[model samples]
Target chain A: AQTVTQSQPEMSVQEAETVTLSCTYDTSESDYYLFWYKQPPSRQMILVIRQEAYKQQNATENRFSVNFQKAAKSFSLKISDSQLGDAAMYFCAYIGNSGYALNFGKGTSLLVTP
Target chain B: EAGVAQSPRYKIIEKRQSVAFWCNPISGHATLYWYQQILGQGPKLLIQFQNNGVVDDSQLPKDRFSAERLKGVDSTLKIQPAKLEDSAVYLCASSPLPVPVYEQYFGPGTRLTVT
Candidate 1:
């Protein structure tokens, strides 16, 4: 079984600053995918960014990027120039080619200060 | 493109009662998923369907929880004789088949409160 872990339970960052949320996972498979999702108060889960385990290069989506270290089984998300809208519950997820469902970690609540 | 849709944004029921939630996935999506999200925790997979066929439901509590994705489009999750511990948000997600990228789109969850 694959499990994702988000060590931080809550994080606060000032506006215009950057914050990095840490995530680690345990998986036996060599091929897998990692994802970060944001769930706002509206209860909608939105995709932030994703990284493929085979890719050596990190995945970047504008202000959201991931520092993926496959050897360490660590995938951290970096939000650059944080804004108030970044306040939400962020989840780290893992899915391997052997399964169709995504295994999610306990979320880390982020509070963006203005 | 329309995202996944879930009905009954909120539901309240007493223990031993029955409740059901609905979900409509994005058009042309070949896979649908149901998840249970407890308060202050991440969403846990309850079931997965590949075009009306069950793919993985190992985590589903079959004794009380049941789900169906008829016609491979709309889905429904039902809990019979609900328990207080079942209080949580039910989320629905969908993705296309041959998911090389495995990007899933989610819907606003249906919050269920079992008193």
Candidate 2:
């Protein structure tokens, strides 16, 4: 079984500043996928960014990026130029090739202060 | 162009009562998932289907919960005799089957409260 751990329960960042959320996972498989999802108060879950385990380079999507360390099983999210709209709950998830279900972390609430 | 669709945005039921939730995945998507999100926790997978076939259901509580995706389109999840612990936001997600990138498109979720 794979387990995702986000040590930080809550994180606050000033608008326009940068913030990094930590995540780590335990997986015996060599190839897998890592994802970051944002759930706002609207109750909608949105995909932030994703990283493939086989890729050495990190994944970037405009303001969101991920540092994926395959050997360490660590995948972290970095939000650059954080805005007020970034306030939401961020979750780290993992899914293996054998299945479609995701193993997710407890989630870290992000607060972007203006 | 529409995303995933879910019915009964909110549900309130008493314990020992049966309740069901419905989900309609995105068009052309062959995979669907049901998740339970607690108050302060991330969504937990309840069941997953790949075109009407059960792909993964290890975390699902089969004794009290049941789900079906007949004809591989829409899906329904039922909880027979609800429990307090079952109170949570139920989320549904879908993705194209056999796609190299298995990114899940999520729905707003159905909030269920068992009093």
Candidate 3:
């Protein structure tokens, strides 16, 4: 079994500032994947970013990036130049080689303030 | 392209009653998923389908929950004799089949309130 963990329950960042959300996971599989998903008040889960365990280079999507430490089983998301729209509940997820389903952490509620 | 679609954005029902939610995945998506998202928690996979076949349903509570994806396109999830703990958001997602690990596109979830 695999599990994802997000220790922080809530996070806040000023507009235009940066914020990082922490995530960790436990997996026995040598191959796997990690992801960050955002759910706003709209109740839609939007893909923020993704990373493959085989890739050594971290994955980044525009203002959203991840610091993936495979050895430490950590995959943290970094948001640069945060905007109010970035306010949402962020989730960290994992999937083994099958990639059939995702195991998600509780989530981190992020607030962006002006 | 159109995203995944789910109907009845919100639902309220008394405990022990039955309710069903509908979903239509993006055209051509071969894998469909049903997830449960409780307040203050991330979405948890309840079941998954590869085309019209059940691929994974290990976490689903079979006694009161049931789901099906017919014709490999649209899907439906149902809960019978709902419990208060069943009050949560039901999300539908879809992705292409096989390698490359395509990102799953999500639909606006249907929120269920079992009172």
Candidate 4:
């Protein structure tokens, strides 16, 4: 079974600053996908970014980027120039190439302060 | 395009009572998923459906839980004689394709409180 682990329970960053959230997973499958999702108080899970394990290059979307180290099974999300809207529960998820179901890690609550 | 839709937004029920939640996936989506998220924890996949057929229900407690995607568009999950442990948010998501190539759009979850 594949399991995702988010070590940080909570994180804080000043507005306009940068923060990195750590995530690691255990998987035997060579082909898989990693994702970061943000859930606001509204309870809607929004996709923040995603990375394909086979791709050596990391993935980035606007201010959100991932440092994906496939050999170490570590996928960390980096948020640059953080804003107040970045306050939310962030989850790291994993899904194998042959499977559709996502395995999510316990979220890390982020707080962006002015 | 509209995202996944789920209702009722909130539900309160006592132990031993039965409750049901509904979900409507985005049009043309070939896959839908149901997940249970306990407070302070990540969402756990309870079931997955490819159209109207069940693809996975390994984590779902079949003894008291039942789900159906009758028309391949709308789905319902029911809990009979609910337990206190069933208190959590139920999330519904849909993807145009079963592969991870397509993003899974999630709905505002239905929060269930079992007292």
Best by DockQ: 4
Off by over 4 Å in 3: B98-100
Per-prediction DockQ scores? 0.71, 0.66, 0.68, 0.83
Ranking by DockQ: 4, 1, 3, 2
DockQ, cand. 3? 0.68
* Top candidate, metric lDDT: 4
Q: How would the docking of model 4 be graded?
A: high
Total colliding residue pairs, candidate 1: 0
Per-residue alpha-carbon lDDT of model 4 for A8-114, expressed as tens digits? Answer: 99999999999999999999999999999999997689999999989999999999999999989999999999999999999999999998699999999999999
Per-model C-alpha lDDT, please? Answer: 0.92, 0.91, 0.93, 0.95
Candidate 1 on A18-100: residue-level lDDT in tens?
99999999999999889999999976899999888888999999999999999899999999999999999999999897777
Model 3 residue A41 distance off true place after TM-score fit, in angstroms: 1.0
Task: Score chain B of each candidate by TM-score.
Answer: 0.96, 0.96, 0.97, 0.97
Candidate 2 vs candidate 3: which has greater DockQ? 3
Each prediction's Cα RMSD? 1.1, 1.3, 1.2, 0.8
Off by over 4 Å in 4: none
In model 4 chain A, where is the ten-residue run with the lowest total lDDT? Answer: A40-49
Displacement of residue A86 (Cα, Å) in model 2 is 0.9
